[model samples]
Target: MEAHTDIQTTQKGFRCTLCDVNLPNEPTVDAHVKGRKHQNLFRLRETRKRQVQNSVFVSGIKPNTLSTQLIEYFEQFGPVQDVIMDKEKGSYAIVEFEEQASTAAALHRTEHVMNGLKLRIKPRESKEFKVVLKKKQDGKNSQVNLDALSQELCRAASVNEQMLRVVESFQLNENERNGRELLVKLLQEVFMEFLPDCEIVPFGSTVNTFGVHSCDMDLFLDLEKTRTFQARSKTASEPTGEGQSEDGRSEDSILSDIDLTTATPAEVLELVAAVLRKCVPGVHKVQALPTARLPVVKFSHRNLNLHGDISIKNRLALRNTRFLQLCSELDSRLRPLVFTVRFWAKQKQLAGNPFGGGPLLNNYALTLMVMFFLQNRDPPVLPSVDQLKNMACEEEECVIEGWDCTFPSQPIAVPPSKNTEDLCTLLAAFFSFYATFDFSASVLRDKSFQRECADAEKYCRSLQYQRKSSKGKSWGLVRLFAPSCPTGAGAGGRQGQGEGKERHLELSLPFRLAALPDAVQRRLGTAGERFREQWFAMVRLAVETVFQEVLGCSPAQEEEFEGQMDTSTSSDAVAMDTAKEPEEVGGHDQTEGVAAPSGSSGGVVSPQAGQKRPFASAETSPVSPQEKRQKLCAAEDEEEDEGAEPAPSASWCWLQRHPVWAGRRKVRRDLLKARGVTGGGSAEASQPDGGGVEMELQVTRHITAKEPDPHDLVAFKVGAQVVGGSENTRAVLRFTPLCDQKGHFQDFFHFLEIFLPKTTEAFLGK
Candidate 1:
């Protein structure tokens, strides 16, 4: 009797269906229904119901299995809201989750073994699912199981394994391809009503077989067929009285009025954009890029969440896309290797969609490089385009936009490659090949010109430095003696030590530092000691940052010592003379504005600005050479007393682990001289002929005092060329090393090099 009463209570007791709240009496139920809490719960239930509308459908449920058991088992993934079963038609169930993510996750588990039966799991069917997007289509799913794939990739031991995992995670599955095809067909049907005979072709990554998840779909609208149809219409007597198209749309359409032969690409794109916005059901965000290399109308499908573009002029791109697809099909290894290299470059911030269209390499360019490397591999992993072209039959020969586009249509037409390198080995080799690559020698416009000039000078210097005695100084020292170290016998050593070290090798020697001339030491006085200490510190930092960190070489160690290099200046007269002060360049007059800002690139005046010789006094001789030299010396002494310091031309903080800036000064001097102008003269002195001649001579002598590191903290003043010729100013670069020797601070330096100059220019309103 108690059991019967419990059953009756469960059947008829008052309960809030929306919140699943039980009420003991009718009055309590009425109050709960009218409460704000119940209203909020009702809204939440509606949202959950909408989310599970895209639930996972399960089939092959056993007769003994109940809905409660199904819910309990699946709820481990997420909260299961409902489990609707129908055993009469078939043992099937729709398992709904409170979240859409759960549905997406469940779709990845294609087969689930439950109660000795293998059940097929898929997305619940909807009327629009086939026409739009299906979580699972034809047994393969649309979304990747990222958690599982990420775990697998993390566990991968080699680059080869990681690359393969990346490919598996990112590649388009057969079902996705089929869905894209269906979408293309649906679009074709809609376009046919307007274009009558136009053809829509898929291109780019979508069909190139290197597609990643969510990559944009590229489509080409071929209007050539429309021209052929129009020609037929003109030749016919009545043209079929403007009948309806196959899809039953009007034959007289806005697109029909367009003459493809004469219509501008922009006009056609705008027309497409208008059609997509007004006529297409799911298309949104319709935009036209008329000024693109190939004008296109871009749009996104609401239901599918897929972005696409339609182009009127991209036939060459289509051919290239086909070629890439063929190359990918020829070998299974190509796709994985390309994907891995692209991923690495992106991780390194070396490539991306650059701002203002800077020189950042795109994915296509990287892919080509990979393909080229493979083709040039030992035993040849893939055949070259020329080889593929030669394999084509007469009918298979093709040309587009006056360039050969011929290649074997099928993979079986070409013989299989004999190269057997594994993915891991290939990936490792790819990095090793690029890390040591001298891109300046092989690519970049400026590098090519620099190389040509360097080679000529190098050959001449090598002949000059040919050894007089084998037991004498090594070629390393011989090259150092040369002005630019342009030589061959010492080329190997210079390459090993780097150009910067080649410049500093003699000066940095302990013997050379100890044997500093007395006259030079006296001239520098107290500043000389401070200068030496700073120079040593700069060299240490360079070695730590460049060699130890970048090259993975053992760091050269130095012993600490207190030497006689220290010289303290206590005399007020000497302090007053040597103290640094801001000085103007042309004339030490009050008329000059703030001194020109310095940078790695150029000064206040650009290289393109038409400039006359700054030393105009050289052309007119008022005094003899000796008397003029005396006057110039006297003027320099007076300026020294006035506490004038040389205005720095430019300053830079370089972060390359190599010595790229080693030979830059030489290039700058040569470049200035080539334009028939001295590189370092002030507007008032150091003229082309003989003006400010004394200052120029002193500068030459000082620059040759000892080879110097540009990074050393030294103050620049109005003087002759100190380091590089043709500069009237001295460089006072200060090098302060941070304690983090292993490159914790190197990133900040790199970031500065990239952005600091641009920011400086922006601040100056350049």
Candidate 2:
């Protein structure tokens, strides 16, 4: 078979480097090579190559000279196709001709004149064509330079000064702010030309006082005046039966095509996207997300290296941005405290999903949480939202989308907060306050988040958190921002003195009955008094499936246990069982156990380990869903006496040979695209949490097939139990690695920390 440079063979398939896509076989590869999209991109690349070859870079042109003028002067040599001017400085322009000879002709000329000014013409610079991957503006890389940032923060004299350093390091600089402002002005001008009286208002993080570098620019397209203009134009045109008025001004064709007031949000967003794609210079990757919670037109500005979103009806967001600005103005300490807390949350992985949608908390939620904590302070460091509304005068009143968004337009109209706490103290207090907060009754109820707050609270009390390290070690805010480690594991590896010290990784999947589909919820409700046990059994099956089927871990041997086993008392698992209706009582009661294998090693447990029994076999005869549910329920009821503690538990032992976690994301994305799943769709392939169960299974298969077989990485035991008192139910998995010669277990455990719960939810939700 002939070989192609662009097509490379992998363990599972062939990949097209040009299109960045994977093909499963020779036929598919052939089809992909002949695809329209691929062919178009190939032609486009060729065109760019020709442009670089036949174009000349011209300088010394007048600053005010337009591209059309340059094109006219360059046309004397040959036919001119396009002219690209440096809009920022206007010092240079690139003019491309239809023929290669045109470049030589232009270079042959002794002098070129544009508006009677001599121009410098030279061959255009050539560069390689490489795909630039699109990156979200989320602050996922805030820790990328942690070592450098820590070194700087460690030099601070105190925690208060350290926090000030954080604000300085993360906040947007003047140049960035100016660039955003220029982009906004340009957008305003372009939109006005098409839709007269339309206003593009900047809001969100860019205008909000808490903005960080690289945060997205959120714009609200206010079309109220434009709608009115269209209405007036329609009335005027009715009498004349023409699109133009007496003054010779004609309604823009784009605006005449649709009535903004009557159009659907999707239609309006499509129009906005069209304008952004066709009219805006330096803008690309324009997409209309009409199905989002807040319909928006997403775009990227290449010159600014910025991503932005434009929405048609987001007046409330504008008001919220103003509110945040007012809060920052009222208290100078608020900005530093918010910034520090947000960074801490990002480090702890309690907030900030790179792709936007996930279970993780967002910056806005974290900021609001800080404000809520401040409002509860002894002196009340900040006013409540309702209080702010009350403070607004009659003329200052504002309403949007039937929501009372009233707030003083200026800080002078409101009184300053009476709280006088320092930034360090307030930051520590913020963690302390949320540590014991009853999340079940509040909207921030996520067990993992509360556990993180409690951990941060403990760290805040340590001497290292309060003062700088004299020995140049990580301390104060620096230590607080470090990635959290598992129990018995220090910053890098096992902390204790014993070489054989056992390390455990724990994760909890809370029973969110409300989040389940109605049919599933009704089925659980039908289970009545046994609902918790049934749900726990189902979760046990899902965990087994994830380990053996999805993650490609082999089943070793199932061990039968009669009593509750000792579990870790680490702070990470402190409140693992707590929830709203039925609160966790801080313990587990074991009933049964199942052993499963993990990794490529395919190792087996020793016969002397224990008696073996399978609760739900991952590899066996396929059973009907109803039969499987019945078997799980029957297993829970087996050997159970009346009035006994009803905790249905299972355990699994597995061997993992391959690092399935490595490159799992890329594999999953490729699999999703191969399956014709892209964008934000309802399918599991579009999910940020490792996609759906089947998709994840495919991803694991692809990864393991490609990954080299190494020695047994780690053999671990998984203990699953259902815990929660009356209302809240949760499934807790406890991981205990039998061996850790190379410390690969920690990495595996960390991946599971997020992957397990999310994938389990995906399974249960299905």
Candidate 3:
């Protein structure tokens, strides 16, 4: 009678109609619902549910006899359960156990078998179970399972053991095909030890289809679980955990700008990075790059032979991540083509010099070439980053996790192995198609883009940076540099160690506390030593995120897509708007502004007038329907191909068309010459022997709307001309300064995401 009563109570508490142990408030009995134990339980529940939903399941077989079987030997672990094998049409079964514990045991122990053959054992499942496991999805209406994803990829690769460890027996070496990825993964594992939840993702040619002999890793760092951890910790500390969350929601500045209670993703990432860098090793060059459209940091440890950047953002980071991720996917197929084209380029000696010439081939030049190659294909095997985002699933509609780590992918459908197509035709198609791809809309339609135009408008208002003491104009320069972007102008060669190009390479190195002036460096070194905990924490996160998630497509689409085709891009440029500021090419831009007076909607300018209009809605507007259809053209041209044009002979060459960057070359020249400089020539100062020259350089502190300065002259300040141009004395650093026409350049490497590279003085700060 007592046993019966216990069984009845268990049934009541177990919440399962078939269970009988309803022990009340007994932590021991309910311990399964807490800690990793609980997570393990949920995992089992989901696995079982998937099997049931897929119409396949486990069944009868005694313990000892069934260990080798799949989906059948589950009955050995507990009380006997009803095993109904329905071999009718579907490949499944239903095993209802007498106790809940037995079912859990079955899930943990089940072995499968079919037709005198052993299959992989999984637990019983049901439609209801799937619904339960999909709470995050049902709560919003999207289905993205990251774990199953990892499993699927593992199964696909057939890498039975845990993590992928390349066998040492083979003659191993970093090759164009896999060096960067292999390095990124090694870095990821090291950083992961420090940042359990942060992510490291690689994008661009390093992972793209068109990658060649020498390529750079386009990385992004991400943190999504940090917020949940913070919230939970707070809840655990406070009695009114739930109440405080709801009440504190309004305290967030973004609460006013957006309905979302979450504060800035940038801020959260900052905190998380600070927490992880403390535990990571060999992360010496760690530094922040907050101004990057995605707040980021770049670093390298020669000891480990790893160098990369980290974009610190929210879970939604996948949007931009997927952008590049998709591009990388496209590259997988485009790579063979890249190799072919590059071989042709080398044979033709068209790889431009590293100091900015077309004959010198850079990774960017190669990507452009490949883009042209595919656009010319019969069916265009790869879509532009803009177009591919359209096919990605929306964030609210899907939740992706562990996207940045590594995973096996589906093979792309390429032309027949021997399908020979001329490079010229492929080249033509790329130029025509990309030049006209509709960007403004394609970007917003990203699977995870939360199209809160109003909220974005508000956030734009709050972007204030620290102001400089110098009152001169401050220009906002935005640029993205990766091997994939145009690196050098001539044939694909670069100056080495002691050549003048060394200066540019120096400019490219990440920061070192010791590199600063004695005073500044001392302070930083002390700060690093004292705050070593926080410093390491931040560095570890920055490194982890760059390799974990920044380069990965979100699981909802990316993981699944990888199973098919990857399509991530290096960066997403949904340009922001900015207010007018003074014009000065060399002016120091201010990053500060008064908080706009409080109003209903939030913005950077704080709706100075009425929270209605902060600045003209410079938000990138969508294109027309007709144009959209034209964009969908099967044989469209490559809209933004940097190739297909002759290299300009002069810095002011564009003046024949627009003369945008041809600043006051004469006046600037006079200013420098008056100061004892030799050809300090700013046309603005010199009345052109032929005519007057004037070009307004828009300068502002906020980077949101900064227009690009004209291109810099390729000539050395001393103008050795043809003299000293040999290997002994050429330009040291040949990389184009990371700036853009719309003040847009995606430098995968940047200092604090802005300012000058301490190692390189091309920017004002140096």
Candidate 4:
């Protein structure tokens, strides 16, 4: 048989790492894993590798040679630094140098022929690159004063309303983006460094219908070839990238024909930001987080700041994203519903910012849950995205990408009924559905919800409402569209752990949004209700924060997860979507910790989290590169000459990674009232009131393995049982690892911290 890939002999039974042959009682199998035959082979491979450092693969070397022989051979260019030798693999190791330039020189100078073996030398990809960029850019960027700008905005907020409006208009309106076309061209030139000939398309409020002044530029960086979007148009003389007609007529094309396959997504986004910063004077702050809301950057130009996300999505992901975006667009009811709820929640100080959350809720998450709730209703509140696509006005697809291309179609019948009463009814419906809905069974089989909804519809039909909409559609207070998965989309394909197969994951009926286990759930439920009870504003904050914390608010990550959620944190993190791990690219650790709150501090944009203000810091690496070690005598003299400052401990940085977040109802009185006295408004409200529901959540350990498993990201499963329900109502969910560390009580606390306050306010309506 061929050599076993993963055969290892541990203290327990015979363990075969690769070929799964459990020879529990066979001593031969055990010995086969750890014997002189394997040991000698391992040493021989290791010895050969040690002959030349930084080699990708080194094997079959004489074991008798010492380190001095390897050092002498490489010393020809200059003095060498530390050498890493893999004793067992005998395959490869890394070598560091005092100077990066010197290291670069060495990589070029030494390719092969070191210590009787060809060697491989190249710069190792590591976090060290961050340090070099950080140090060099730090000084130059200091000139841009972010604090002054923040102070100016804050002062403006206090007095000058017009200034804020002007600033807001620049951010929210499409007209502000007029002078930005030239800027966009510059950006395209830079992005082409990676995508070569791909196009950058801007959508959302930036294009107009209902835009605000402060809205971030929502752009879709399309890296696909030009042939993809080319569709026939109505006009004959218009220039198009579309195919030539058989009748010798020019076909319509959405954009110019282009080729785009030479570069990766990362390279594309980086180049665009780099080029924009160089060409645009007011544009700066280029952050490239591929795994963020969208793999792009957020920067400002000419007093206007915008964040752009790149979508190099496959046809399926693209279709899904576009479908969802269209659903929000088709119904003026959809975007406004979500945006209003989000904004209200923020204003009330119940949740964090829509874009940034401390332990904040994501607007998308709440919208999704709402969508699921409405879909499960009888007759379904709205159509799925695919169904909507088929029903959209032809003008929805009307493209006008040429210079000065703008929509000229007649406005359709969309209403303007944004009021608090409608919001309250929708929320009431939301709670009722969760309290009564069952999601474990087949969705199509759940007829009770639809039946009740039908009854409600009949009741509404008998009653009188002013005007009618498309077909006088039987309206549910809260409308939703749960698009059925396409047979072609292959929803039944190999399922991931966190990913749902049939429909996007749905909550079972027993899951009371307000119900927490009496021992644990009651306290949480009460706190959440209490927060809701207070200034209704507080409840809004909780909604935004929790949605993001429990679900997800990240646009880019959401798009990624819409495809697959890999929950594995092992040596293979960069490998594939087989597993997902806790996110910790920056010093910020995703270890389950206290979720941040919703307020000015909490509601701020996330990419700007940990950062105090915008335009404050330059884009650079986080750490500094190591310096060359001096000779022993010189090092001793230097040390003797000056005492050094102690290095910051890991614990300090660890604590700094997570910030405290809370529901407004939890500690409003402490924040707004002096001397810890309860104010007015509502007693159930944690803010105005000095008292809170004194209860503790008892979290049980549900870890399956006693020993550590490197591949698993889930620490445990949390189950909540309602105390007073007629029938025992229970809720259970699997928790993914947000960090590698084991002892993470913070996530639980973050949940309860914001949840309890809001739950309390909800029940009491304080």
Candidate 5:
């Protein structure tokens, strides 16, 4: 009877219980629930429920109440999630429980007595959360929900799928894109009003389409048209009797006091900043970074919650941005790979600058490295920048800051890649390629000498007559990263350490010479020896070049130091320092002035004018820890000795966090103790401390004292293995750990596999 009286289940309207609102139809009800007000109320209801579900807000907590005591008391209710104390407001705290039932049970009592004081209990309030978009300072990171991303990646089907998922998660959403676009349009309109003919163009990640959700917007203030307009206006207003004002200025001109041509870059930037601060609505945090590599007016848009920079003379950044965009558009694989590598680098802590003001391999550098790899692959996956330039139309030809930046603007202009490899295989290959690459050299294969006309007439010409073509052919002539040729265990290796000499000979000896008939050996005699030496010299040069240059053991030495590039700055429009060459970390090659070849007795053994001079003390005898520290400190303190030959740069072997190298002293001690040697200074010294291994220890100890940088001491020397060559030469590995401690070494070594090459490259300022 009650059901019959009340039953109106088939009502025309639907209702929202949380908002306490009714609607006309189901669709209207759906719309109402999804509407802003309804959503807010729904959020509030959920937040309130969540706060009360598993948490009890205590109104009277003692200031001295320990988290341990809270846990002890709260355990009576149920397992505690966390206890958040509101210390500043009052002696209060919110004790969160693992179960809602426990929270409700605890609340049923409604009151409690502790420390002889009564306390009132309620539900904790949920704090509001907001997305904070911030500029990346040198050592700080903006807040990101990376844990959610990690979980998403964990659920991905494959590494390929994971990479794509990561990109999809981070890529700018439609709302963000629309926000940036609107801001760009508004800024452009304002700028055009001030300069009349100026065009505000977005570049960098913002326009590159590879932009992540919170990447900074880079705008190029194209004042070329404005400048042209200004020149014409000046010509037309040249004290004309009809249209000139009494001040001899154009009547329509607002820029009478500002001479666009004569104004310094800093002045222009300041002017831009002034205009933005005064006239542009929603634009704030206006600043002029005149001393920045690319002088720009940086600002934030209140409406968009976005940061941006406006530059007047950064054409290079524009070109670079276009190039990146083209690459992204051409290959679906490029962006995903870049995103994966970048995230991996960030995760492993290999990519952040340590606030000491040295270069880290930024996203730009990483992108270039990937491009180089693709261009170099067999049946190449991507065309060279030079090839792109060649395909560019006449109208597309561009020169910025004396560097040709010509490349096809459209992805369609680029020919499809011959490489049909899947994303998973390519990703695996990328890691594998870098793992074995020689970082001490350029990644580009050396331009091979080609005989344009291989005829009888050209046969008599000297090797010097075979000219190297004007730099780039397949790629852009300018190498993105050009490290020094690989020295390998050659010029970079330490020598004269007893058996080291024999190892060197073993490595350098020609295999052919060992098998030559005795009669032939006798007949050739000294000439044969010279021939063998020459062959070894050639082999060393060839091998080292292949390892260092082609393999990328070291990071490429950049042709010029561009200074610290602002992430917000456009890559194409950045004013390149074309004249200022990078000061090489390894300095000028010592072998440059050597007259003899590498394998000659005179050349290999003796010091040359520019070559690294072997230290008699270091080469002939072992260096004590004290002496080593003194030398390192002195070297670190002293300015670059411009006149003196550069010393051989110390090589580092990276290991993951393992007790292996750290346990060296213990291992040595144990070995000593096992030999029944105890309580003597000699016992410590007698622990199989081979020369190469001892040298590595000395290097680590000294460098550690000198730099005191955590990163510089990442790897330690545990032992050495003689990489035997021949009777004359050998290379030594001064830091080989005993074994992988579980998978710790493998996991750590994977990072090193990426890190060492990058470290070498970064040291060279590639």
Candidate 6:
């Protein structure tokens, strides 16, 4: 077999570097090498190479000189292939010849003339050939600017002023808005040539008055007039079998390819995509997403560095955009409040999923949430949507898609809000309002978002959030905008300090019986009112299995509490308590075990009655891992004790002897390969059964067997308790790292922050 520079042999397959794809076998590799995408990229690379070699950079050309005149002048030396002018500032252009010799000939002349004006000509600069990576439309540059913005906001006179500064820093500048307007006009002109009378209406963030820099330009392409024109042209030409309209325009244009009245949304979108790709200059990456909720043709303008979506069936979005604009105008406070909340949500990772569709909340949804909060304020900062519809005159009344969208066309038509709360107070109230919102009844039922709102509400009441800092530390809006850690987890003992201190790490595994399959739910229901206690015991066993058998950790001292202990103690105190009396590794001297009651299938013991048991060692335990997992499902049915305390907690110490958290993903892949499993696993592995647990255990074992043994990195104490009321039950685990002279505990703890919950869930689901 011949080797290609772009193709490299991997363990399981051959990888194509140019396309960033893997091919499984010789036949697939051969097919991929001959594929259209691979061939197109190869030709593009060669064309770019030729352009660098055969092009001449022309300067000092007259601004109004046409590309045709430049082409005529350049052809004197040799045939001119292309003339690319600087459209923004027509001071220079690049003229490409048919051959490199012609470029040399033109460069040697030193002077060129076009339309009686002398032009400076030089050989085009040589450059490396590299593929242009697709630009992510996430507005990441705007996020980068936020670091500078925080410094600027820190010097503000008050939190209200800092918020205004945030708006000033993020909103589109004059140049940016002008560029978008020009782009829209350019698009309008291009689409008019093919689909006559079509109008491109800008909507969403671009014109919603709450726009940020680099936001995507959402355009509603109104083709109703064009559809009428098409029908009229078809009728006019039907009698003569000719393709000319009454206005003498050619009816045999791109519109002739499809009947707008009869065409499917996907078909029309494809036509739009074709027009964008073929006719629009500087437009690339044109894609038609017909399957989207609102079918759209997504495109990017190369020169403008902007991404945009063109939708033909989104008239409702235009009305919604106008409503947002009117609301922003009615109350001056709305714009800054929306901007600050959006930024805070972005920082908290509760919103802004870059690729559009995900669990994260979008900007529009977040804006509406703010409006809803305002509408519910004590004095009512904003009117409800239905109320706004009533406020509009009869002449302005309108409906779209079976829903009323009428609103006052101008801000002057509506009365001012009576609520006179300052931006600071409104911002704080926005957080506090949503902290206790009933999201389950609405579409915004994301628990993580609710938790973040509660945290922000607490911060908003603090002095650090209400006032500026005198010690020049981050305070007010700056502190609020800082990226937050996961719910119960904190960074070391203090914020951002990881080394030379005791670290406190916590994770919450909610009782998600409702999220389980019906069969699993039925099995859990068999435990009756004592289900919570049994579930907690199952979680404890899962945690022990993950640390000992799966993660190669040795169990130390273990303690169980009958009721909730003080959770407000400092990390230093927790560390001192663990250090004061260290128990021997894998010791059962101080441990007591209470066997499961009456008819329990397995000999599973309850950790509740101040009873503890050592975790089963991988090499020494009589039971297999699968048996241990089965024991978790065999819970004892017990009657509920009405007078019992709601919370029972357990604490255990573990000494980690390996970096089990590191490189587990690669090892997992290798182990799956060894087992001949593809796509992670088959359908059974995806089930909530014990398949995932066994796979993860195998992954850890593979890593431990391959890597050299290291000295003890850290010893941490984990305390577990079932918290939350009836509606939101969860197992909360607080980790206190007692010994960390090597500083590896923080990394391990951060890994467990995500790992422990997921693995434990798999165990409990089994």
TM-score for each prediction? Answer: 0.43, 0.61, 0.29, 0.32, 0.44, 0.58
Q: Distance (Å) between predicted and true CA of 400, model 1?
A: 1.6
Query: Mind giving the per-residue lDDT tens digits that candidate 5 earns over 43-135?
Result: 765665675568888877776676667778778888898776653444777888988998888888856876677878876665553323333
Find the candidate with the highest TM-score and give its number.
2
lDDT of 3 by residue, 1-766 (tens): 1122112344445432222123454453444343354456567766675445333245343333322233345446554434444322324445555566766665664454554556454545444432232122241221133223233323322221111211111112356346555556765765444333446776654554333333334566543443453354345654444323433431222112222126664554454344234324444456666534346665654444555556654445444444434444644445433443443333223343433222144545655556554754565565543444344445323434654322222224222223243332332233334434432222111111111112222222321111211333220000000012122321112222222211222111222333335554454455522222222222222222221222110111111112221112212221111232311111222221222212211111221223232121213112212211111001112232332211100000000012212222343444445656543244433332212211112111112123244232111110000011111111111122212222222222121111222112121112
Worst lDDT window (10 residues) for model 3?
Answer: 647-656
C-alpha lDDT of residue 577 in model 3: 15
Off by over 4 Å in 5: 1-144, 237-254, 352-359, 442-766
- Between the candidate structures 1 and 3, which one is better when assessed by TM-score? 1
1 versus 4: better TM-score goes to: 1
Model 3 ranges off by over 4 Å: 1-196, 209-214, 237-278, 292-294, 314-333, 340-362, 379-766
**Pairs in steric clash, model 1:** 645-717, 646-716, 646-717, 646-718, 679-726, 680-726, 680-727, 680-728, 714-732
Best-fitting candidate, scored by lDDT: 2
lDDT of 6 by residue, 389-459 (tens): 87899989989989888888987788888898999999889888888886533444345666667667877
Task: Please give the distance, in angstroms, between residue 271's alpha carbon in candidate 4 and its true position after superposition.
Answer: 3.5
* Candidate 2 TM-score over all chains jointly: 0.61
lDDT at residue 32 of model 1 (Cα atoms) = 67
Candidate 3 positional error at 14, Å:
88
Can you rank all candidates by TM-score, best first?
A: 2, 6, 5, 1, 4, 3
